[model samples]
Target chain A: MSGSDASATTLGEASERETLKRIFPRLPESRSTIVGPGDDAAVLAAPDGRYVVTTDMMVHGPDFRWAWSAPYDLGWKAAATNLSDVAAMGAVPTALVVAIAAPASTPVSDLEELADGLRDGCAALAPGCGVVGGDLSVSDTFTIAVTAFGDLEGRAPVLRSGARVGDVVAVSGMLGAAATGLRLLFSEAVDAAGEPDRARFERVLAAHPETVTAQLRPRPPIADGPLAAQAGATAMLDLSDGLALDARRVAEASGVGIDLDPGLLGDDVEIALTGGEDHGLFAAFPAGAGLPGGFRAIGVVVPGAGVLVGGRPFDERGGWDPYIGWDGHGG
Target chain B: MSGSDASATTLGEASERETLKRIFPRLPESRSTIVGPGDDAAVLAAPDGRYVVTTDMMVHGPDFRWAWSAPYDLGWKAAATNLSDVAAMGAVPTALVVAIAAPASTPVSDLEELADGLRDGCAALAPGCGVVGGDLSVSDTFTIAVTAFGDLEGRAPVLRSGARVGDVVAVSGMLGAAATGLRLLFSEAVDAAGEPDRARFERVLAAHPETVTAQLRPRPPIADGPLAAQAGATAMLDLSDGLALDARRVAEASGVGIDLDPGLLGDDVEIALTGGEDHGLFAAFPAGAGLPGGFRAIGVVVPGAGVLVGGRPFDERGGWDPYIGWDGHGG
Candidate 1:
């Protein structure tokens, strides 16, 4: 990301109070927020008797590189991913508490843009949800940990362990674009020595805006999550660790099996099946109950174990595990 | 701080799934948990219409060092600090979503102990409050970000902006011990070259268990928060920053000044006034209202704009701001 603002000052040059003054105004407040930032704790309304909560962390090197993502993209992606988890539980997002740690040398403008992205992301994906509280600190590596809260709105949470045999499995949102964009960034946006090059990344992003944007700032089908639940989704989860792996999770949790039709997946079925970071909703519904408007049927629950594609067992690792997959390289 | 488990394995040597399997059992569950870990999001009961929420982060170098703190201490401190924020709001802590990122070389056993600490801390400080969800990731530095949720139980939130000039200032839990412990750790528990020494840390800890333990694992009077609120506290805040700074915060927020009696502060009044990380409850109550059992009078709200000690303006730079205070040395 370019830090070209003439007034840019690194966090190290400013006190925490000064840095907060610069960024706080850009943050959005939710209707549910009774008390917003600047307090010891924020008070949020949860009209229902219950709330849904989840947390996710994105680390600098293992999650994204500055060479490939801007501060805005980082903030938006962080919000999107965690909001998806809340939505996956068939809840409407209400508030977020974000904690960020970055190197002292990071430019203050970058943090402002990050706050803007967090504001805009909540505005776009979950209209009534916004940042309620946050903490900022210094670290050698930049990291964001967002804890998202959602209101159940008097509805039962959709769980992955509710799928039953003879149910139809459907998915909402794009499947393989993010993973494909990641592949492209890794393969084409690097210099001769394999270090990510910002200039080349811009070119690649321009060449594949749809895919690259999906990877950088995903627009998951946030509304469709509650829609699926209202339509009586028996089992549901957000597609994060690839279709095959996530589908298998539902299968194992529900004590059933999933058999997907490859033909239902768009071209490059392999990528759609085993690629990750889709942030889409994958759900199961009663066979006759019709899929939600944004959902497309891709499989069916069967009385067996594991996942299958075209009636055959499908297992191709199916996802990325940072602990085992990271190659110890930022790029 | 010892990684003495013979069966210890580095995060990089195990898959995320295997590591979670070891940790899930150690995490505590709250009675309000409708759905705990293993789901897209945990569903927690928020019986009241509103919930108090807060987040805090601890970074490896700036917030802690392995040479001085164990994984257990890190986890305990992380939970204690965040939980204190919830309590400060006059709410009962209900759940926490913790996200952690550590070096690939960190031992799995250390993480297990960290989990135990999280479980035990919640069990000890705020009974029935427990870890409901969390995220694990890889980073060059060990970082922990915890977001705590609390139920107000129908009481109006006691805000920092609610104090009046005639209110009496009171406090629960010890002040300055944690900061004093930090000073001792830095000065006495370091090698000749100024790097933290594990042996020296152990020796210093043995020599001054009260202060050292206070720094590593604070036991803030969590219950006294709601007790003070029920006793008609007009305002309250947790003392994370020093007494003077935090008192100034409450004073500015409430448009009043705080006059503290130095005689009430124990010996070493300077440290008691300026040292940070106390995590005690500082509150304001009506002048004639009886103080809660655990709380004792320390000051009075005055008709001014800052903090006063012994009836005079107190302006020593009280408190630590990581951005300015961190000297780029882990020790």
Candidate 2:
């Protein structure tokens, strides 16, 4: 069938031969790819002699819901999630491979929409880094797993083990927006009725439109990571967990103490310290190093143990623990 | 708890955090990795460079069955499946990250065993490689997804489009063993209540124990891929979708025809033509180039179209098609 004329409904039922004929030509070819999709595996070139890799999985229920997320959003989220990992490493994302599992009954239109979303996300976050290859399988529920790769270009990999005493702690991008967005989505403010809670969801829309969008679709600070690394940042990481817990991690990894400046947090101290899912970058700079663009100094590393928020010992009373759920007030 | 005193029952959950701690001591000091695992997103070292990457997924029901496969086997298979792709590109396997989804009730011991399996698989298949990172989530069924990275060592990648009409088709490792082994495992003879079917299963098992193991745990010829590239193989690929289909892929990509000599099958035409899950290296060599070690001449490139078996056209009827099921045949 012609590319534009091919219907999504027929993509799965058509034999593997036909699928190959239709899909193979649409993919782009690059000199860095020795082998592209269609083989058992695609072969890629790692010019830097070292490669950085990461993976993430999005399940239909736990990670996303179809009623709330469009197929394109699902695709975009899948790519964005893994890209955040690669970006968090201060690496430049070069390519991605995705494995998608959905029910046989899933409309082909949905799949195409998902692909479109993936293309959009990659284009926005990582130019020239497209979906190089992927596998499609039939499953009872929809699942999307994406893997991303980056090149260090012969520079030493900025590992989590490099923080030292006297380092300056800093962050880039907004924190807690995604977390608050999620809270708004799940709260009683959104009713679970017509169109899968659109009415109640509207309340969330009315309350914090930007935060809700952030929660629904996180846009990782892809460039800020590398920028921080280049700016003499001594230690760096992505803020996925709450600030306090993640700060503790940096302290432990760097074998130093972390003291956060509560005065700097303004009104969102609780959300800033306890929030999760903000794909922002946090780095520890050498003493006296100026912060880079999009970054703000937030704390300092000292010769002690654990993390202290606003000079007070931080506890697990706030933030998120997978088993304990959210610990912030009203959460 | 002491390493020796660690209880197997608590191995999965209790040790996960501890293992992260243990790895801290072995990590290299890098400024790019500002934050590590304890945080939501890891800070990584991204030097100023481009990146190359790929991803794959393994579902419980479609890829492996726990009834006959152990947790360790599943882990090894998952890692191997992704690593093969990295290797196929003439790249040295570097780091890997995994995302797993499984039932909450899954035994802790099973999860630990799976982790051990991943470690063993990476060590054996791609030395110096580490699991590096991962995510764990609860799901109704088991799913494993791995993303792998590789270093190209400055060599130009061997693309599928470089094959010439006179190229020789060569392969490394055995074919059809996995497919045949799977057949024996799923047949009525193996799980049937009757004596006759049981006898048939026993006969097949006795005759092809290696085949059964091959299906259960495929060992991809990872090293051969790079070797073939270094040896100047015009085009190369990994054999996963059966010989005929995969060979056709090479032909289509190179814009040439391939002719297989059935007589060269050496008494296992069924396995050579219709086998799946071999994960072997298939390369097209210059007409006069010597076959690399571990590779055998199986076919030749011709000046026509598609793949021909014994001078005759081959169809998908004899091979594995996930949509059509196994159909109780050679595939």
Candidate 3:
């Protein structure tokens, strides 16, 4: 079936072309999208002679709960997580291509709203970015898998293994904000709401919404990444799986140790150390270099073989393992 | 848990790092992977100053059947589908990034086998291409979403919207093989096998394996796409959704109509016109432009609205409609 073949009453079973017409105009148009959605593939400008590519997928039941998140929030989070990886690479995200798997029973309006959120997320957070292409399919479960391509603007990518000993460690944005938001969403006050969904969602948002928003719609320090890279940061990565675990990753990759000072993170010290999904940029730079405005010192890179918090060994690896349920079901 | 923090007893519940360690070696490495899997994002060389990117996903039930397709075939098909899109755009595939979501209960060996399949697929089908990066997540249903990045080598993309009315329509490979393969897989003889799965698969393979292979792991005319583009093809697309329907797409996009000659399709005229998943390169060239070696004229672009079969308007829309189900399960 074609786009023009659909009638007003036949919107529920609209052809893929028809559905795409509704989505195309809503997506932001960016200069990087040399060939946008509608073709077999999209041609995007690489600009600096290289492409920084990353992908992340969110599945229903595990990645989001419809009882809490709207379709729009899911779309925003999907774009946010992938874009943050590009940012962590010290590149400016240019375009996104999403492949969505859904059951045919899904409402057309829901998909449209999701596309709107995808466009809005890029515009409000990573300006000059847009969704370039997409593919749709029917499946038993709902899933949104997004791939983002970025341009480095002629600068070299900041890899996690580039850290050197004596480099001052810094993070752009709050650590563990998403972990705090997840905990809040599961609290008795939020889970025990007896009202209908709309009223409950509004009420939930009315209470400590900023933290909840961090979990549902993360606005990572995207622009700050390139600025830090330009300012001579040697190594970088996004705090997707908490500072402790991810910091250990960089330390291991760079063949060094890290001395983490949780106290420097203020009141959310523990969360800052162990919380995942923060999407903050963690980097290492020469000790005396001027820091980007969004960054604050978290610790220093050391010449050793382990991660030390407050100069002492830390045991808790409380970061999320996607395969393991909170109740230890799958694990 | 960190990469070195896992023990023999805890392998089943091993941390993400350990699981990734097993996956990393299984993925094929390429020179284009400036920064590979262990980084925040993979950096691939885009020497042409631009990149051609496309994505596709395969689900457990809808896209493949575990009983019919081995892990290797699934990997091959996933890679083939996305790479074909790059080929359709007249580009050489440089790298692939795969995101796999599967239940934690899945065996470690199975994941390794899947990764091996992915590597083998790249080595055998798309030489010089490799899996550069990936993300692993947990989900009840298994899904593999792959993104392929390509280098245009400074050539203009062959778009579906560029076909001219007088262009000759051509195809680079067989049509309807996958559709026929699907029919055979559903046959009673294959369904009634009492032998072990390995023996049964061999027996099935002994009976016209090429057709089944077409459905499971299509070897699309990848190199021929660029060849046709270089040979002055006016428009191009991969024969993914079938000839008649996809031809209609090109005609619609270019404001022309396609006149298909079913008799010229050799033996499987019906399949040639309607079979989905052929993955052949379909192109339109100037009336007398020298055709690529692999291409043969199958029709002609006409000056009209809808697709015509042998000079008559054809009503059957046999292309795959993703929203509709084979057994009416979803729509």
Top DockQ prediction, candidate number: 1
For model 3, what is the C-alpha lDDT against the true structure? 0.82
Q: Identify the candidate with maximal TM-score.
A: 1
| All candidates: TM-score | 0.98, 0.84, 0.92
Q: By descending TM-score, how would the candidates be arranged?
A: 1, 3, 2
- Collision count of model 1: 0
lDDT of 2 at B51: 29
Question: Candidate 2 at A207: error in angstroms?
Answer: 4.3
lDDT of 3 by residue, B1-331 (tens): 3435332213237566778887789887865778888798989898878889898988876687676777778888898888899999988888999988776666655677787887887777678899988888776667899989887889999999988888999999889998888766666224343211444556666797888889888888788888888998889998888888888889888999889887788797887789899999999999999889689998999998778989999878988877655332210
Writing each residue's lDDT as its tens digit, candidate 2 over A15-114 gives 5455545544543333356556655456555566455666677777667766567888787777777777776667777777777766655666677678
Q: Write model 1 residue lDDT over A137-165, tens digit each, in one string.
A: 99988999999999888899999999999
TM-score of chain B of each: 0.97, 0.82, 0.90
lDDT of 2 at B270: 72
List the candidate 1 regions with Cα displacement exceeding 4 Å: A1-6, A329-331, B1-6, B329-331
lDDT of 2 by residue, B1-331 (tens): 3446543433234433554444333422222332334433443432322223457777766677675567888888777777777666666666666777765455656776777777778777777555656676555557787766555555556666678988889888787888878877776334444222435555666678798768766788777767787888888877777888788878888999899988876578877788888877778999989887688898899998888988887765455655444111111
What 10-residue stretch in candidate 1 chain A is worst by lDDT?
A: A1-10
User: How well is each residue in B258-326 modelled by candidate 1, as lDDT tens digits?
Assistant: 999999999989988998999999999999999996899999999988999989999887898889856
Question: Which ranges of candidate 2 are over 4 A from the true structure?
Answer: A1-48, A153-156, A164-166, A189-199, A317-331, B1-53, B152-154, B189-207, B323-331
Error of 3 at B27 (Å): 1.5
